[model samples]
Target: MTADTAVLPTLLTALRLPSIARNWKRIAEIADRDDWPAARLLATLLEIEVADRTSRRIQRHRDQSGLPAGKTFATFDFNVATGVRKNHLLALGTGDGWIETGDNLLIFGESGTGKSHAVAAIGDALIDAGRRVLFTRTTDMVQRLQSARRDLALAATLDKLDKYDLIILDDLSYVRKDQAETSVLFELISHRYERHSIAITANQPFSAWGDVFPDPAMTVASIDRLVHHATIIEMNGESYRKRVAVARVKGKDSASDN
Candidate 1:
């Protein structure tokens, strides 16, 4: 290799061009073999670096998103979720359009009705579209915020969370009406109100949400904030898992009869 070639990696590193540093040599060989002009070679090299950097950033965001890697829209069974508006959900899932407006998504359904799956699918889509998202169970996130509050670091934690464009809080019905925990959750909601986006999945309707928050007034306030600018999706149908289980049982029974 020439002295110039030997120094390319060091210069790329010094210039903080990681992708270019790793692949420039190999790409240069192709460029030289094709007798490419200097401008074309530079453009191609920079383009690869740009694309590679974007891919890496997406992967990093995906890793931090708390969403299951494989839970994508393609894997979801939209046929089972008839009440959900596929196009509307898809438009929201594309990232930042609704979130930029600080709107919320309130997903309502019974257990096993694919509510969590649907939210995760949307989160997966958003993350792939170069948006940051965080998925957490309602109780878990509350507990985290509660701990932060105890440590007097609640503000810092909330500040850190502001980096995410969307926060998916699953199973809103499961959190107990404990003051300490619910207060933190309420604070989170109030803090993010009209500022950022949140997608929540719940097994109960609004009329029953008072049971989830201790103070009746707090419950009303929470619901008001969440619903004020929210797109509510109701999946009121038989559980998908139950139907699949029943079908399997019927299939086994028919086989035995045969």
Candidate 2:
């Protein structure tokens, strides 16, 4: 209500401290009522501003990440996906050192075995931990890269992607064995090798990747680079979707009988 208080908002806006600008008045009332020290009040405001900025940054990263919603680790069923260790994933979720060192994460499993969900969950964790991540279908990313190549902007596009701490390519096996498409994919893998992290979900083993990369030699090189410094997780189990479908049918039958 004072002249000084009326000018506080404008000053905060000029300083670009939106969080502090918005909450400072309410917090100051609490500080005064509680008889807090000057240092405590200042520290509290700074902490609120930092936390608000961090939340906004994470939200922005999540929006740009293209990650599927509701696929976070909290919702993942570790019991069904028995091959994946909860402890190991929890450790990886921290993204403590591997992401910094550009280590790759390769997940291999059959369709509907929760590979995509698992990786997406890990990606979500990395984002929460202040790491930037991009989630895209393997084929979609390859098509974009191919277009970039044709436009003579392939290098620039790759350079732009380097900003992300990790790129999650879902369903590697779905990419057709076309030379052009596969060539662009190979180029992406080669470019990011040892420079950035890539987390890939695949339905096929390395031996079957010859069908993904038309050139056997290219396949070999790609595999070598990906596995050189990677944590390979093999998810082997019945399809989660299949089980859910069966359960739905049983529930319907039981309801009809009742």
Candidate 3:
């Protein structure tokens, strides 16, 4: 091979075009066989590089997002959660104006009502749309922030979370009502208010949020910030899990009869 040909791989590496480096030779062979022009070859390689980079970026985000697998819209039961419209959910999944402007998402539902699953599905969609998202149980995230506060690194911890376009705090009501826990939780809501976005799933209504926040004033403030520019999704219905469990029992009984 000529020195020019031998140096092509190194040049591609230096340019950080791994996709082109890996696929260029095969594409070039095709190009030659097809009698393609130089411009067509370059364009094909560049397009491949761009597409590969985008795919890798999306995968990386998905891996880091902490979203539960199989919770996508396709796997979700839209019929069961009739309160949430499919079109609205699909629009939210696109991460259009809401994610870009740092608007919050509030999902209120009882246990087994598919709040977590819906938010997780939405989170997965946001990741696919090239938005960074973090899905954490409310208590888990609170403990993390509490530890940070204890270590005097609360600000740094919150700043690190800024990298995510939306942070989904599943089961927000699970966090025990305490000074330290609720304080940090309030801080997170306050810090991200309007500047960043948060998606919360809670089983309680705004009136009952005092049970979570301890102090009525803090509860009001938290609710205000979260609701100010938020899309509220109420998923009030029979528990999806209970329905599935009942179906399984009936199936077992029918099998026994057979």
Candidate 4:
């Protein structure tokens, strides 16, 4: 083995990605030959492969259909993000954190904020850490009940809900709830209450949840169980869409100079 290449294999072994390590050898050959264009080409390939791997990992553990795909614990807004209490959110992520070990997480904010993304990211993180997770929009959850009741195996489906360590309910106000949907939702929450944690993202204020359930009494009961042992994250900021627009404009201007 050449002196220069000998040390490279050892380092790549430490990285734990054999394919990446092999790619490194090809990239090194390009660099040694002063083949600048070939080096750039190899670097680009390496970047694409790494990115693809990262995407696969995120998608594997994430509920891509139910919530925003990009939401992640790492990308979650922690700066302007405000929630229950800093210490509490910290604990939620830690093994002993209040929300850490499958305790409920409630994120309440206006539309276009990062509520759904934040919860989804948490669920993704939990999945990667060997916990089972499920994500569903409130509307989809209600529709599932509509199907289950018709099929006569609602109990079995409800049992499936309990199988997950964490469940995410996003867009809680997508449709108005009837007595049947409300009852089923309550049952699921009651069953999971304290036994497992739920992460809920909502565009409506908690006070206005009645519009979904329609029954004042049932709404309060549901909230009591879900929030009693939960952490409430209140996101306050401009629309995330608006923030993106501004950033894109800035980027476009910078690119025009080049």
Task: Give the 10-residue window scoring lowest on summed lDDT in candidate 1.
Answer: 176-185
Once superposed on the true structure, which residue ranges of model 4 sit more than 4 Å away at CA?
1-68, 80-91, 99-102, 178-180, 250-258
- Residues 1-258 of candidate 1 have per-residue lDDT tens digits of 889888988899898889888888788899889999999989988998899989999989988888966777898888878678788778878865588878899999889888998999999888878888999998889989989999999999998999998999999999878546677888889989999999999999988888788788989999999999998998878898899999999999999999
lDDT of 2 by residue, 1-258 (tens): 999999999999999999999899899999999999999999999999999999999999999999999999999999999579998998888898799988999999989999999999999999999999999999899889989999999999999999999999999998878647668888888999998999999988888999898788999999999999899999998999999999999999999999
Residue 254 displacement in candidate 3 (angstroms): 0.8
In terms of lDDT, the best-performing candidate is 2
- Evaluated against the true structure, the overall lDDT of model 2 is 0.93
TM, every model: 0.94, 0.96, 0.96, 0.67
Q: Roughly what TM-score does model 3 have, to 2 decimal places?
A: 0.96
Colliding residue pairs in candidate 1 = none
Per-residue alpha-carbon lDDT of candidate 4 for residues 2-43, written as tens digits (9 for 90 to 100): 798688667667866556666776666666687577758667
Off by over 4 Å in 1: none
**Between which residue pairs do clashes occur in model 3?**
none
lDDT-superior candidate, 3 or 4? 3
The TM-score, computed over Cα atoms with residue i paired to residue i, of candidate 4 is 0.67
Q: What is the lDDT of residue 217 in candidate 4?
A: 88
TM-score ranking from best candidate downward: 2, 3, 1, 4
